[model samples]
Each structure stands twice: as structure tokens, then as C-alpha cells.
Target: MGTSNKPPKLLRMEDYPSWADKFETYVQALNYETWTAVEEEYIIPNNENGSNYRLSQIVEGDKDQFLREKKMLNLFQQAIKVENFQLLQHNGSCYSIWQALLNKDRGNPDMRKSKMSLLKKEFDIFTQVKGETFAQLVERYCHLVNEMKRLGIDKPDYEYIDKLANARPEEWGTFIMFQQSNPVAYARLNLARFIEKLEAHELELRKNHNMKSTAVP
Candidate 1:
């Protein structure tokens, strides 16, 4: 009976930790020592002349080199983002994904400034984008605020709340006015609490409106 000749499975994209837990196991299984070992026995190939070399002696040197390169390539591939895979796939260096992400984030000053400017514009015009739920809007708002803070543009908590209240629909005016009236309580409400209260108020208003509209004319 003929033996199966199936090649061993190569590390795949799924081996990355961003998606799964296989990368550590895979790395642990890759034995650098075994890869670098020399063979103890000599093999004579057919049609060879006087010189005979050990198969281990010939393959061991290349095996270490091959495994080292494979390990580096696998790490590099794992570090690359799926979105940037096409752009950076051709780059086969040994840099990690965190390094790549850092380099991208710490781009030239002009690029950083440009990104900051765009973020500021988005923040200035920031409202609940159409079809965005309250939670989604809060997430987007907080993201912009955090990004601006990272760029050293942090403002006061009240200022952020003021901006958020301004961005909210007119239906939120009652809550905004109530906040304005109760300065002490309002001051105690952090961004999260503020958003939660406003969202609850909006929901209550919606429920009341729905109930009224459904009543007899």
C-alpha cells in the first residue's frame, strides 16, 4: 500500500490571537532546537560519486534557516490588520503588529494634525447621525472626545456635556432645562449618567407621544 504524502498544515491567518487562541500553542510547538539539530546518520544517494554526505548534515543547516524565517513571517502576518493586509502583505520584515499600529498612529506631524483637524470638525458638527441610537451616538461622541484628549485637546466635563446637550434633538430640551435648573445634581452627573438620563427622558417622551397619538380623536 502506498503511504499518504499530504504536506503538514502551514500556519493560517486564524492562528492570530486577535481572532482566536491558537497562536500561543502554535508558537510553543515550533521547536527551534529540533529545527537546528544535525542528523547522526549518513545516506548514500544513487548515482553519487565518491563523496557521500549525511542527510542530517545537509538538511539540518537549511532546516534551522527555514524555520527561523517561517516563525518571523508568521508573526509578521499575524500582526498585520486585515484592512491593511493588502498594503503591507508584500512587506516581509520581522516587525510586530503593535509596532505597525504605533507607527501608523505616530505618523508625521502633518498627518497627525490633519487627523486632529478632521476629528475636531466631526466633533463640532457632531449630532446623533441619522438612524443612530442613543447608545451609538454616545459611543461616537465619547470616541471623538477621547481621541481629542489623546491629541491634547481635552476640555472640561461640563463643556463636553454642554456640547452633547446642544447636539441632541429638540426633544431633549426638557431634560437640558431640568439639568440647567438643578446645577448641583447636574454637576454630579458624569458624561455617562448624563447620557443615560437624557436617553431615558427621550424614551419616556416617545412612549407618551405614542400613547397620546393612539388615543381617540
Candidate 2:
């Protein structure tokens, strides 16, 4: 293999259609199984029998495939720039890491600034959609935050929390008011704690609505 033990190369940004294409080309030249690790997302061959398959009983083919995937991941990680590494920090598999990079701005490095600008605009106007549960809203908010962080745009959590607070629906008015009244407590609330409280309140609101609907008229 021409790329023998050579980490996947991060070529000139202009060479590929997207930021991830350079790595894709490198991986394609690595080897059959390693390339498949990213393309087909090769998985360990499973046992045909219904019986439990022990770790010690893993076949040679499956073991070789697993090792190849590990090598691919290690090479990709070691070759990527530190600033760009965040894109794959949460990803485990070769396919996942590759997908994360491809999802970033187009091959043009200049487009990154524009992409960040678009993300900021979206964050400024972000709000929970109607019929979206509090948990779902939090999940969406976190995903946006992660995307921004991956691009090196770090916004204060507290500031974003305030943005989230203001986006609550009319039914959340009382809960919002409660948080507003206790400024100190609200200031102390991080995203996780805020989500916990919101989930509990959501449950209570649903329970009350159900009881009211079932009451004798």
C-alpha cells in the first residue's frame, strides 16, 4: 500500500469538494477492509447460532475487521489538526467521525466564517417548536451548542440558558416566573439542572391537565 502506515492525509482544502473529502481519498487508498470500515461501516461478523457468543470465541475474520477499524480511527485522529479535532471528539466509529467532518462547511476554508455567521443567526432566533416537549427542546439546544463548539465558537452557557428561558411557551409562564423571582437560584442553575426542573414541571402540567379533563362537569 502506497500509504503504508501513513496516516490519512489532510490535503489542500481546494483539492476536494468538501472539508472531509481529502480524508476520504486517503482512506480509500489505505486498504480494502480499512476503507470499508468507513464506507460500508464494517461491523464484527455476528454468530449465526442463537447461543451467546463469548469474547474468547470471536472468529479470526471478525477480529481482523475490528483491528482494522481501530487502526483507521487511530490514524484519522492522529492526522487531524487539534482545532478541527472537536468534530470527531464525540464520535467513535470511522463512519461517524468521517460523517461529522463532512457535515462541516464546504471544502472552502473561507466558507467556515460564513457558516459560523449562519449558526449565530440561528442561535439568536432559536425557540421551541409547538408540540415539542421540554426534553426535546433541550436536546435541540444542546445539538446547536455542540455544532458551534465544533467550529470553535464558544458562547457562555448562562447567556444561552437565558435565551432558552425566554423561548418557553405560554403554558410555561408560571414556571418561568418562578425562576425569574429567584434570581440567585436561577443564576446557579446549569443546563442539566434547568432541564431536570423543566422536566418535572412538564410532568406536573400534564398531570393537572389530565385531571381537569377527567373531572365531573
Candidate 3:
């Protein structure tokens, strides 16, 4: 058997397309503490006068600091951009480097507010695009809701259900019609049941359309 030469898939920050796209993946990779252990364990010691030396100026004699610096050097080499690499190079210690990276990548309060506003605006006018399946549309709608909640903009479950139902494409008209005929029951139904009922009706409508088309020819 021939050996494959493909690199192993390690979780690297640079793999994601953008900062927003990277947020969830990065959080999962580093967990809740976000590499704090690395920062604490790899401390840079002070000089004879008790003032710490800059990481870039650290000497070769201190094997531990040298190795720590080398690890940081490797991190910068694998960094997404030259600017990021340069920024990381200036850190006095691992903690400072970690803090800098976190601050640069994490969204602040104002940024979160702006993002929440935009997501809410889009959700308010949400619509299933043409040719989009019921499952796909529901998935998108649920994703938007999840993102909003993550940003601390929690909304009621009923509100989400209403918005999702209203935004559905015309192909889901049969489902809407059924809901209209039994408004009380529909209003009382849970999201899972709602999704199943809507998708079932959508499938029935497609089946009927196909049957009619075949009969016509």
C-alpha cells in the first residue's frame, strides 16, 4: 500500500474564512479558559534588577524561556497574516500574547449590539428563497435565532415559530392553509411538531403536483 502525504487536520485559527466564522470554532478549540494554562506555565522571568526582559530580547541560556519563545515563534509563523505575526512578536509574556489575541479576535459590547441589530432586522423580514426546501429554510431560521441568543438577544419560542411560519415560501401554502383552518391547535403546537406537520404537508403538496403533471401528459 502507498502512503498518503496529506497533512493531518489540526485545529488552526487560520482555517476559518473570517473572524465571525472563526468565533465558534475558536471557542471550542480553546474551551472556556482560552489557553490561560499555556500563558501561566510559560512565564518569562525578570532580570537581575527584577525588571522582566522583552520576549524578543530573551537570551539563549535560559532553556525554558528559550523554548517558550520558540513556541511563540512557531505560533506567529502559523498566524493568518503578517500584521498578526508582528503584533504577537511584541508581547512581553505568553499571557500578554494570549490577551492580545483574545481582545483582537473577540467581539466587544458595541460590536455585539451592532451584530444583534443587523440579525434582528434580517429576521424581521426573513423569507425562504425560491427552490429552498422546508428543511433548509427552517435550518436557516433556527440558525439566525441561535446566533441572536448567543448575542444575548433572547426571544420567545412562539415568536420564532410565528416568524418562521410567516417567512415560508409559497410552496408551503398548503401548510399555512392547514394552520389557518385550525388556528387554536396550531398556536398550541410545539416547534418540533410544527416542523414535522409543515414538512409533511409540503411533501404532500409536491406529490400532488407531480401526480397532476403526470396525469396531464
Give the number of the best model, judged by TM-score: 1
lDDT of 2 by residue, 1-217 (tens): 1145665445432322433544556666666667777765754444787553454677765776677777787777666766566644344677776666665434346688787898899899999898987778888888788678767888665777778888888778888888879888888888778878888888998899899999958
Whole-model Cα lDDT of every candidate shown, in order: 0.58, 0.70, 0.61
Model 1 lDDT per residue over 1-217, tens place: 1113211232333323222223323443554332221112112232365453433544665554444544545553554445555533223333333234344454568987887888888878888777888778787788788778766777778878888999887867877897889888878777778878877887898899899999959
lDDT of 2 at 28: 68
Query: Mind giving the per-residue lDDT tens digits that candidate 3 earns over 1-217?
Result: 1113221222433432234334424433534343343456455677889876765667667655556555543443443355554644334555565555554443576876788789989988998888887788888877787667656777766687778788876656766777868868867877778778777877887899999999995
Candidate 3 total steric clashes: 0
Off by over 4 Å in 2: 1-107
Q: Candidate 2 has which clashing residue pairs, if any?
A: none
What's the TM-score of each model vs. the native?
A: 0.54, 0.52, 0.52
- The residue pairs in collision within model 1 are none
Off by over 4 Å in 3: 1-106, 170-174, 180-192
